[model samples]
Target: HPLFPLLALLFEKCELATQSSECPSTESFNLDIQAFVQHQDRERKPFFTEDHEVNDLMIKAIQVLRIHMLELEKVQELCKDFCNRYITCLKGKMQSENLLRSDYGGYDSDDSSSGAGSAAGLPGIPPPGMPGGRHSVPPGLIGGPPVPPYYGHPGPGPHHLS
Candidate 1:
């Protein structure tokens, strides 16, 4: 639940970038349309026109198409870059969450240890009940003497407290 806002923001940014990149610039579109219309108009003209004029019209049309093609390629590149960044962001978030869980003694749901000292497997650490481990006995109590249970009297009997 806490990650909702961050994920929402990320998605929003991705959507905005995609929309902006996918939509061709209005000015560029208008220019392309104008060039195409002029080319068509030139073709409809009288056949008596000079050969050089027809060649110039053909060249202009080719140039306009090339420009449109380049713009499409640029938009495609932007989309690819955006997708890569989004995937990286998601990976970073997942790694951070795992680190937080480990720090707080939370084990992965798939782990078989059931929240025991999973750190025991790591280097420079000891296992449970071993020396310097989480469940290890203090040095002073290690094999020193046997502790006797007190019955509140020398002989074993139910004694009343006065």
Candidate 2:
């Protein structure tokens, strides 16, 4: 899963947040809709300021690719909403990394800080064949049940066009 690296970063962020008095994990983190919506609203203001145009185009492209039913006006509104949530999530993530770096003085030399940068900077790709490689197993496969292998199957994965 390409998002494995991203998920790892989020897990790390959750660990960091557990240390912050302001970010105590309530049952709300799982079941509180009003608080989540309020948090989203609070985070909407500065999230898309840097790349609004490019962000809009990317949103359109994703909508097109996913075959979402797109009414022009509604899609535009939804795009704005989606981008706000996306940017808010990203900001939270970036903030977590900053906190970790400032508090812990960054990772030790042997760890993959460089890899983290590369993975976060490049969205759908990871360093090839690494443990969290984009093409590796799904991120949530921590010991529960055996996950069946499915990558190199006979027919065609998403890469095949014809």
Instruction: List CA RMSD, all candidates.
Output: 21.1, 26.1
Model 1, position 151, has a per-residue lDDT of 59
Stretches of model 2 off by over 4 angstroms after superposition: 1-70, 108-162
- Model 1 C-alpha lDDT per residue in residues 1-162, reported as the tens digit of each score: 222232343334344544665644435544654654576568664322356666566556545544654566577788789999999999999998778677654542323344333442343555566567767874334565534445553332234233
Tens digit per residue, CA lDDT, model 2, 118-152:
33344334554566776466533555654444776
Candidate 1 colliding pairs, count: 0
TM-score of 2: 0.26
Off by over 4 Å in 1: 1-54, 105-162
| TM-score, prediction 1 | 0.33
Task: Estimate candidate 1's alpha-carbon lDDT, on a 0 to 1 scale.
Answer: 0.53
Give each model a TM-score.
0.33, 0.26
* Model 2 Cα shift for residue 42 (angstroms): 51
